[model samples]
Target: MTAPTREPANPRFHKEIVSFTRRGGRLTERQQDAWDDLASTYVLDIPRHTSSTSVDPEFQLDLTETFGREASTIMEIGSGRGEALVHAAHENPDINFLGLEVYIPGVAQALVTMRHLGVTNIRFAIVDAAAALATMLPAASLDELRIWFPDPWHKKRHHKRRLITDDFVPLAARVVKPNGVWRLATDWQEYADQMHEVLLSATGFEYSGVWDERFDDRPITRFEGKGIAAGREIRDLSARRINP
Candidate 1:
């Protein structure tokens, strides 16, 4: 499959924008053990950018080989602590789940949880979500894309740092198969509005508005719980790819 052409950065947002900041934290013993033993098995190694031209084919991830068989694939970006991903993998053993997370401790924590639960359908990669989408993932290969409770970047100046942006919408649309769903959730009202607007305006996607029911299968992570306790409304948006 031919990779989709990445769009130019929107002039509305910051020219040099990043969705996440790398933070340092100490890992628990279990996490460290899992990271050391399971990382080679679960974490993908993506090559750094080598040229200014196009993404190198050598760095592309082979989904069929990664999962050991062909199956429906769901990718969750910013899978913090991996509560939702682990639960989804356990519940849907036939479907392959891949998580992209930049935080080291969160990746380690997820590895430990997966080991304890004996889940085999999930894998992870330590990489920027946009970069991976643009370079590594195969075109029209993903069945679903989930972005739950991504960093809001509340400050006006930092809003450009938010993950859901004008440029990212088309990138997501390019990777998802026709009729595949893109699911998103955020507690911040402003961010939710931005997400809705971006998704609606993006070509090849049809906005379905908010989800009718709570995603009960997705466990409420600590961040989500905090948002609930603070009386923040949890907004969900789902869209389907309408163009190939």
Candidate 2:
């Protein structure tokens, strides 16, 4: 459960460790079309602090007002391409879903999926997940938090950039309600070990002792496909926040 002491040099204004890199790439035809037509509807217009992906700490995100209801809420961290989020939103229309993704193309693609499937219960934000967890969201707001197929940061030196860490565990616990579940999936053994090692002793959460089964509803993404193609075992883990 050792936390890495490494952090990026001079992050302009904040000292918080960032997880994902901002990838700049031209969108595909479908992604561009979806972005043009549906972004205003599905993407949030939240205030930013430092960078475009940075969240404004003082900006309050009222889930009830945004989703137009106060039903059970699920926030998916790093919701790449939105297959699972869209599927769950379509399957259970009563629940409100907010997907946190930094990549534009993935978020655009997610909008494409939602549009094509005619799903309306999901919304997205292009904010840093750490900042969202640390500041923007209300405490005990989410019923479930899902982190699927996060980049494992396989290199020993780059492990500090991995999303699940000692510092991140509390930020996650801060947002999830008491008894709320945090579900995570990965295709790297060492990273999976690191996740369990960190969460096992985390202050506000309790880890399930053994590895959990695959989340059947989650559709295989391109990342997961590559992992499977490389013969890596996909591991799913779950933890529950202790009631305050």
Candidate 3:
């Protein structure tokens, strides 16, 4: 395969390849109620430069103000329905959690979970996470980053669209503080292997070159349960950011 191209400076209007695709759907009754009751508190209103998922280049989140206190922040990429995110936030009240997603229905579903769980340490953003990492977040500002079960983009020709690529690793490295840990998991063997390869050689990062055990804090969401029932082995890996 040819070398992967650098993402344009403005990822909002990026060319063909992207880590995620936006999804839309009507919210359910519970979801609507959650949105009505909790969205103002839990969902961040990010200014868009081009589209709904776009984060304005100058728009950096004031997370301390957003969360109402200074705390260690953890960001979960593609936090579908926030099942595991809210669970983790509930378990760790001292830490702040951010769930990044582009799907409106899923964001509302996450709000539904937030209402049921009554967790305040967690918040949700509808911006393109990869773009947020590229320009919106402060350098070395995050304590941890999690990406669980990102779409595998199964076909060989479409692997370029996978989120854990060589080009994407640097953005992750840029945002995570020195010694900050990046935890990722996937059930797709090929995608897991590719993530392993890309992360092992990633600059400003250090890895054991071995798969880590499953993170105990990560709850088994319905999505993960389905992967298990389908007889797929879940691979978990963690890497530490190395300061320059």
| lDDT for each residue of candidate 3 in 60-155, tens digit (9 for 90 to 100) | 888788889999999999999888898999999899999998777787888777777777888888777878998888898899999999999999
Error of 2 at 133 (Å): 0.4
Candidate 1's TM-score: 0.89
RMSD of each: 6.3, 5.7, 6.3
Candidates in order have lDDT scores of 0.82, 0.85, 0.84
Q: Which ten residues in a row have the lowest lDDT in candidate 3?
A: 1-10
Q: List the residue pairs that clash in candidate 2.
A: none
Count of residue pairs whose backbone atoms collide, per candidate: 0, 0, 0
Query: TM-scores of all models?
Result: 0.89, 0.92, 0.92
- Candidate 1 lDDT, tens digit per residue, 1-244? 1111232343533344678766657788888888888887888755655322223555888999998999999999999999999999999999999999877788889889999999989888777788788868988989999999999999999887889989898689778999898888888999989988898787889886655366677899877898999999998888888865
Sum up the clashes in candidate 1: 0
Off-target runs (Cα >4 Å) in candidate 2 are 1-16
| TM-score of decoy 2 | 0.92
Position 209, candidate 3: lDDT: 95
Candidate 3 overall Cα lDDT vs. reference?
0.84
